[model samples]
Target: MTILGFSPGEWFLLVQHELLLFAAFFFLIGAIDELAVDFSWLWLKATGRAGAPPLDSAITQKDRLSGDAAILIPTWEEEQVIEQTVSHMLKVWPQRELRIYVGCYPNDPATMSAAMAAAAGDTRVRIVIHDKQGPTTKADCLNRLYRALCEDESRQGRSAQIVVLHDAEDLVDPAALPLLDEALHCADFVQLPVVPLPQSGSHWIAGHYCEEFAESHGKAMVVRDAVGAALPAAGVGCAIARPILRDLAKTNANAAPFDADALTEDYELGLKVAEMGGQSRFLRLRDGDGRLIATRSYFPATLDAAVRQKTRWLHGIAFQGWEHMGWGTTTGDAWMRLRDRRGPIGALLLAIAYLLLALAGLTFTLEFVGVLPAIELSGGLKLLLWINLAMLLWRAAWRFGFTRSIYGWKQGVMAVLRIPVANIIAIMAARRAITAYLRSFAGVVPTWDKTAHDRHPSSFPSALDAELRFAPLEAKR
Candidate 1:
């Protein structure tokens, strides 16, 4: 009847009280943090500062052609989707000075072949083969592409004014290129919203991406930009000024502007630019027909794949990010960085909360059977519980609103239902991330844990068709 000098009933009561108190405390803290961001966004929206910028209807192609823009697409084993991505990009973006640089590992001959076939002797596409073998970090591949860009500039005696980072799986908006170019005239770094396309059979797994990006890019990013916090780049749909990149590279002995060793190079790039007094903007724009000028792509569709991708992100952004990039000097910058690195802590809180839910159900069943006494809740704990409930509703409302604004009402309902799915994935990813981060101290070099994509946005007949309508006749591959 006794274990560790306590009766089973007493142990149950002790655990119930302790777990409830722990979860309630942390949940309240997290709720407060989230509420701050929410209120800031609401204030921005109320003041008309959060609306999308209007498109310049009369801006000619000549106006868009102020300078060349280099598009960098890095690959390892992306043969399946690289061709479609390249073809679609060439078709949609009509800037004559635009050059598409696809970095391929020399060992990945199949992807190289696919990229070349997509190019089909088009001078705009240049495939840069990495000197190293396959499976390097994506940032390393991107550095190779940057080197190629520089060599080309040296040969042609003309430099690209801005460098755009994208993945081989992305279906870029036709308006995105010129818009990025236009924004770069004032801002050092520009990021457009990323619209995650819903997959057919993987709604619960992949659809969470749509919900999260909608809320984060829609609300959180707007507030961050408004409050002078550093804007983290989404990688794809982001452009950086050539001058800033050159300045960044010069700091590192002119080897590479990006932290090739870092897992989330894009995220760091924007922050690095901001650290050096460069301006960063999350530019959301709409066309004449009111379509969001954003990058569209399919995320990981399976639970395992989703967890893997998220694991890399958490490892990079939370663990390694905290290790490499310390706290910011200013209040706003530090607050944003804290939010960025709270993934592991948040996951732990979520795990405990779920466990408490199951335990509460068991406690009720035990009390009904007269096996355990009814536990009295403290007034403070009760107050925390009610506050947490209200906060949960507030969070859910925002999630629903954001998803509805993007994917319509049906998806918004699904977004609320998919909260548990996202939480489970986050917990799993956090565990994996912590394990991987610990292994780094043992000198285990991190490689590109790239996601596999079999489908491209171009595979969908109607996807990006409106954007493709602007393609030149000769761009049809």
Candidate 2:
């Protein structure tokens, strides 16, 4: 029967019952999924397998070179922060052991000049100009760098042992190279954790990333390791063995290690390596002073920019991935893929839950004022409702704990408070991602769609002293 024909009492009962069933299905599944991740994290910790291999002495371990490593930094219009990033990175690491290959378009002289100025006569730094025009896909730019490395290798008669990837705004740790080098001895691909510095101007927007990465890098990735799922690279703070890159290039006839057509080439590359029977590791380690070994950078600080960035990720990972990567062979592989593709449905469920909560409040307020009949939930329904509430509390506790582990107690508390804010961003991002994906089929293609960056000024090395330091400042007005 239609709600219009049913009595108010019946209508209220029907709506409440249906909503309860919806909650019982969706949130219960989400809670269970998180429950597994929580348990896996506990197992990793209890067994002492959560930590990285402790070096004999981090600070005292002399400048032992790890052969040769190539660091690839791709830029389109990254003129503002390129100089500082390149300069600081070189100063922080052993210049003789590192070769920084910067990719830029010939049309953009600003970034080219900035990169050249940043290198400042350092023979270790090289700028590779792309043949195409400006703002092509980041993958396209990266491909150019890979080709340059190939030609350089042929000319020099020596190949880099490891290849690393970074975005323009990333601030590398002094220990990141050595650690990545150490980890690569055991695995083909190694991804370190990624930390997004806070922005005061858009706390909700930027802070949400802080909490998200904290939990993902802290807990979810650990679970991924426990289960034999493919390790997805975070685009930065990750390194791959040089030979593996060559194997990946074979798929494209020696053109490039990175896929030029993919939206998230980094994510795809990891999965591709796994498909080729390669082992991957998600390294979550700490430095000598108890600092988490990670790549530090600023995420998009404005709501619109944050949403735009997330939209591209959702389109690439969740939507396009399903079409391109396909279902895997094993149960664990399919399970991980399911989790990867859950973004859109998860956001939709959150929207529905919020709508129902608002409606419930309005209905109860009307009933209390005697404008409508009294409403009530049955015993079974009340029990389910209470269980969901308890699960919310449980999830919030973990979220706070994970955030606290990376950031401090202050940011952890904010993580709990910012759940609603994250949901809003996810909902908006999903909608935009779906639109972008659909538009691609209508003869409109997705290009670089890069997020404009606001690199943390303090994160760069000081002009006064090249000694690298973290100098996060409050967002300006």
Candidate 3:
């Protein structure tokens, strides 16, 4: 005869055990949140009243004068935005010494025609068509361009001092070139903060993008600098010294300048650079009017686009980090390697914490449905909830209260209420990413799942019709 599993008191013990595990997970999340808060506080205190030092003061005039610059734009099917993107680059950029290269595929007639039309009489812009066999990722495109640059240097006996990556959707600030050049005096690689344009018409998506940039670029990068950590390279607004790129090419001959197989090549490169012991700096750029003029691009305007973008990013970052972990050989200086390794783990842990919270909630709900005995809430859970609420308030206040100066209290309250939705989105993205990562590890090559942009092109003011017409082709060139 089968014995019944538990007595009345035994049932209580099982509930207590589950509750303890749940509380333990909550405490772990609270601890991580506390660490983040403490780090942020320390960063703010250390940088108090001390603004970012002037770039001119940080670099010598002689170094600035001697450096040669090149800007690379990699495009696939950006027909609608290419003209406006190129036009803005021509109109706002103050530098006359820049050599601009637009990388495109030969078979894409629409994009090729748009690039040609945009560069009509402009001598500075050179369109390089890659006749590759199949659809490779952006990283492959960058590797091809890098190889071309290397070959050109061999033939012409010239080398670029700095190479900048610009995206088709990015509206770069005019002062970015000089700022990067100045920063290059002190660092080998520099990344500028990027902000999303507010013209997307989806307030929720746009607001989240803005908040992310402000925290990641504005606060997090600054903190990373203070702590002497390697700053992750954002794909666009990145500038790399020729020497570093040359060395990278020589060392990783089998790999592209970026990892073609990886989803987020820019991030991988940044980590690789750090592992190699190089100094990568992030420049916080502001305009002539003293307002921050970060690069503006559109984030996903709809929910579907948002999910797709997040899924792609999550898959890329997770796979790259795991693959590199086993390589064992570290490159960049001590500070760089430590930061690179820590960053991925930190992000992974955060994601795990979010997933655990979701699981705990589900378990709690199931117990209430009588499928399982009701679990008694413990003091540890209540303590963790209070602590988490406080930390969330502090973060919200820092972003909306002090920085944005808009509805601090309201935003802080809303952020707490919206935690369920945010956590759910993150958990779903992470789950999708994990599945993709496993498939990749089992030898499946990832394809470029394209995110459709606002192809209509009528949503925003056209730069082609605005300033590109006034200046002569020669003058603009």
TM values, all candidates: 0.95, 0.92, 0.79
lDDT, candidate 2, 112-176, per-residue tens: 99999999999889999999997788888888999999999999999999999999988777778
Off by over 4 Å in 3: 1-4, 7-20, 23-27, 30-41, 44-46, 49-66, 325-375, 402-421, 455-477
lDDT tens per residue, model 3, 26-119: 5455557546644764667586722433344333223233466888887888888887778777766635567678888877778778888877
User: Better model by TM-score, 2 or 3?
Assistant: 2
Query: What tens digits encode model 1's per-residue C-alpha lDDT throughout 143-262?
Result: 999999999999999899999999999998878888888888999999999988777678799989989999999998999999898888888999999999988998886479888889
Top-TM-score structure, candidate number? 1
Give per-candidate clash totals. Answer: 0, 0, 6
Structure candidate 3, residue pairs in collision? 275-331, 275-332, 276-331, 276-332, 277-332, 277-333
The candidate 3 region of ten consecutive residues with least summed lDDT is 466-475
RMSD of each: 3.8, 3.2, 6.7
In order, candidate lDDTs are 0.87, 0.81, 0.62
Off by over 4 Å in 2: 1-17, 58-64, 369-371, 457-477
Sliding window of 10 residues with minimal summed lDDT for model 1 = 468-477
